[model samples]
Target chain A: MSEITLGARRPVIVRRRRWRIPGAAIPYLFLAPATLWYAAFLVYPMLQSLYVSFFDWDGLSPSMTFVGLENYINIFAVDDVARLALWNNILWTLGALVLPTLFGLLLALALNRRAPASTLFRTIFYSPAVLPLVAVGLIWAWMYNPHFGVVNVTLKAVGLRSWANGWLSDYTMALPATFVTFIWSHVGFPMIFYLAGLQAISKEYYEAATIDGANAFQRFRHVTMPGLAETHVIVLSLAVINGFKVFDLVYTMTYGGPGRSTQVLGTWMYFQTFQYYHAGYGSALAWVIAAIVLVIAIPYIRRMSRG
Target chain B: MMSDVRRQRRLEQTVIFLGLLALSLIWLTPFATVVLSAIRGQGDLLARGVFSLPKKIAWGNFAEAWSTGDFSIYFRNSLLLIAMKVPLGIFIAALAAYPLAKLRFRFSGAIFIFFLAGLAVPVQVTLQPLLVMMKQLGIANSLFALVPPYVAFGLPFQIFVLRGFFRLIPSELLEAARLDGASEWTAFLRVMLPLSVPALATLCIIDVLATWNEFLIALVLISAKESRTVPVGLLQFQGEYSSQYTLLMAGILISIVPVIAIFIFLQRYFVAGLTAGAVKG
Candidate 1:
């Protein structure tokens, strides 16, 4: 407690604390880097896009004339392309939401049986989910080729040669063809989620049901379906948001063609901004898409945060 | 009664196996065709369609595609960006997550929610201004231009996972370290980080896969040919060689090999991470 001893201890403490941040400031110091990155890159840009959406500037110009709500108005009133894009977005979202969940639940049920080679089959089914969407588009585009592609080749072999079509380039068939590849890659993703949920359900529930003379279907209806309710929300919301924002697959495969028939909101926004130089209009489209995703996602996110 | 129950279970297993086997074959057919097409020569492909047996294996197509497609440049750019971005993103996220999970601070709940909300905001909504910002910073069309946004976008999920992990690391260990006169920084580096290897590794795998396969951002930001990443490069390669299906397939195979290799190596962690994100957080 003497002054000289205190002075000596103080220097040692100062030396140790030089590299050690104080406890109160520790969180802030740790947070500074990530917060700054998000602020400058994500938050700032998000607000900037919102502001730009109300204007008529062509991206690179120095002056932007405010044309409040005009871009959104045009999407409904005059822009057939926008209407087409919105319709396609809906088709993609609904199909992805329904089919993937059904197929995923099916696969999860199959795998949950603990059959032989189940792990291998799970990996096989899940493999496509990891490949880049660009690669998915390329592989499917080749498989959909009218002359030598596998789909056509298989159809011809099966005595259904008439069913074979130019899948991606045929305007009427392109969207459906694209959906096949989407569903194929996505089914395994939800399967994994459902598998996790299935694993969490206790064996006691099934045992109790079985003792009551419940059949297999009845056990599944009472036990499995209710157990996976949370996972369904996660899977369905993710599928819907991703479907609304689909771009890479469409861009790589059809480039919004055979006459823009496969165009969705995400790619159409890019076409408006980068290709046509209607940057303000694209910003408007982007906001609308983001709004749709938020409308789907926010409720689930709120529920998650609460728990 | 027991014998009947066992027999029925055996029958159910058989049915499940056969069903999964058939579906697995369907799932793998496209990949098999991609690989098969990649090694077949144009002459062979023209003579006998994509599914036909190859009489002569043309391994030379890979070499030709490697050189002619300029995939090497694109691969290097992707590797460079991933190498820079993934570790930095994980480190920043883990650092922030530590206090949020362990240390009690004001507005921590609100801060956590804010980060979670970032997950729902699609990147397209911010694309224009981000491009403008990249231009202002003089990094547009360069690998450096991609880093900031990539790191930022990756942080929300990484932090969410890490916070869950850090919270499980009993506070008793940190308290023990403090009692031994360890500073907070030293405690983090020496105690917490070493315990977090599995979580960090999971994040690394996820982020690397995401950055390597990222398409849309690279497509929008990098216009220069040399600056393009693998996905964008492959897309342009397909555009230029639309009719050359064999070589195009080679390029596709080349692009996916690394990701498949990584997945095979770390599949357990990857699966755990995916489920953890859904089930827990």
Candidate 2:
């Protein structure tokens, strides 16, 4: 009887031990599919791009020669188009940081108060966000047409006809014109974000401020802005990252047009890889862009995680 | 004292109302112009200013743009892409997120960091190699060409957001399920999934918007006219009607209606989803 009981307990213990091994491995089991997909499609290609960046492969003919950083050097040395595109990217990043943040705050403040049709006002303000970049670009392209465009027509009607050139075609106006469309398309997202953040703040803060006889601006400065620090960081980082990656609008609207005056890093990389077939050089440019985003984002990530 | 405060609040409210009214008009004008231009008769479109009230409503313009631009076919293709991509992406993301959110395993954090790295790399870097891979697979110009890459690109962010929501679930419920002899899979399905409907709905709405609006991947993958999505179709319309503002506006209007309709119907989910990711992270 004693041996029978002992044998049964031994099997149970063995079964428990066996289960522990796989139980500890369960997370990997769940993560395997996604990791596999990422490895094959993302990590593999990234490494491949880096490897190919050292070669002079034109994307097709199988004969590859080792170029040994020639592609990177050449891209940096003689690429005026790249320089212009980078400048546009910087301008975009700056504009995205400032304009959307300000507009979103203003919109949030206006809608923060209880009012009739506030929901309608919020919806109207945010409608542009739901439209795809391609659609926005196409619509705005029509609106930017020098002759029949609403912009020029409105300018003419207002007796400011000389101020209106082909908004997207003129070399000087093209980039800023495109930036305006970008701003319009994106401002709604941060507005909604800021609104949610505002609502999350306790009413007691405001009440306390009022009791202290704080003015509106003073309350905003001391209460509202401080309360929105997390939101501010998220918005700023997302805006910067998105600014760096903007391509579709530029592609559909300008196609790096009017002598490549409106080209940004994203569009430039597209042209280099797809059109020009300088896959090696394009990869180098892509790495540069990624490095820029990382430099800006890593500190924020650390700050967020710490909080 | 109370009356003065009330009056001051009323005055402030009026100021806010007027300011919002002006801002809303400025914000809405571009959309209004698109709709008006699309509805205006060709004669009215050409003669009157772009913002003028239409002399006659050209309801036929929407029909014409739909039929002439082959927008119906494009719409179907776009729907198919979204239908396939969103579910598949979400399923993979959910499966991937479950373990990361629930289980304690070695390298879980490292694996997550790998996905975090993916969020920073723009789509352009991956495009060239993806094109090469598609060609190697010999489906370079087909609808299948678009799906794999879309899912690949979408997984990281989807997993990120879903994992955040999943992590917030109480661990005690999961342990109770385990005590009740439920397998991990069963526990996830029966316990976690029902509780996660809101988060899943948010994910679905966002994925729909992103997939439906995706253009760069569609441009690179789908070359045939019939397989092109709405954005590609709209691009073609722009190319073909380079000079005809009215027809172009008509095409733009047609392209936007589906998006606007979906957004309006799912506005709550859309706002919640956007705010969820933005506010939390």
List chain B TM-scores, each candidate: 0.97, 0.95
Scoring each candidate complex against the real one, what DockQ results?
Answer: 0.63, 0.45
Where does candidate 1 stray beyond 4 Å? A1-15, A19-22
Candidate 1 C-alpha lDDT tens digits along A1-307? 6965764455322435546556788777877888888888888888899899999989998999999999999887888989999999999998998898898889998988767878888888888988999999999999998998999999999999999999998999999999999988788789999999889888999999999999999999998889888888888888987888898888887889999898888999999998898989999999999898988888767755654
Per-model lDDT:
0.88, 0.82
Top candidate (lDDT): 1
Candidate 1 CAPRI category: medium
Candidate 1 clash pair list: none
Put down candidate 2 lDDT per residue, B138-228, tens digits, no spaces.
9888777888878888887788777888888998999887777666766676678778888888888888888888888788767898789
Worst 10 residues of 1 chain A by lDDT: A7-16
Q: Judged by lDDT against the true structure, how good is candidate 1?
A: 0.88
Q: Over the stretch A1-307, how does candidate 2's per-residue lDDT look in tens digits?
A: 9975774465221222224435766677777788888888877877788887788777777887888988778766888888888888989999999998899988898887778798898898888888878989988887887877888898889999789897788898888899899888888978898999998888999999999999989999999999998889888988888889989889887888888999888888878877887778887777678778867777555533331
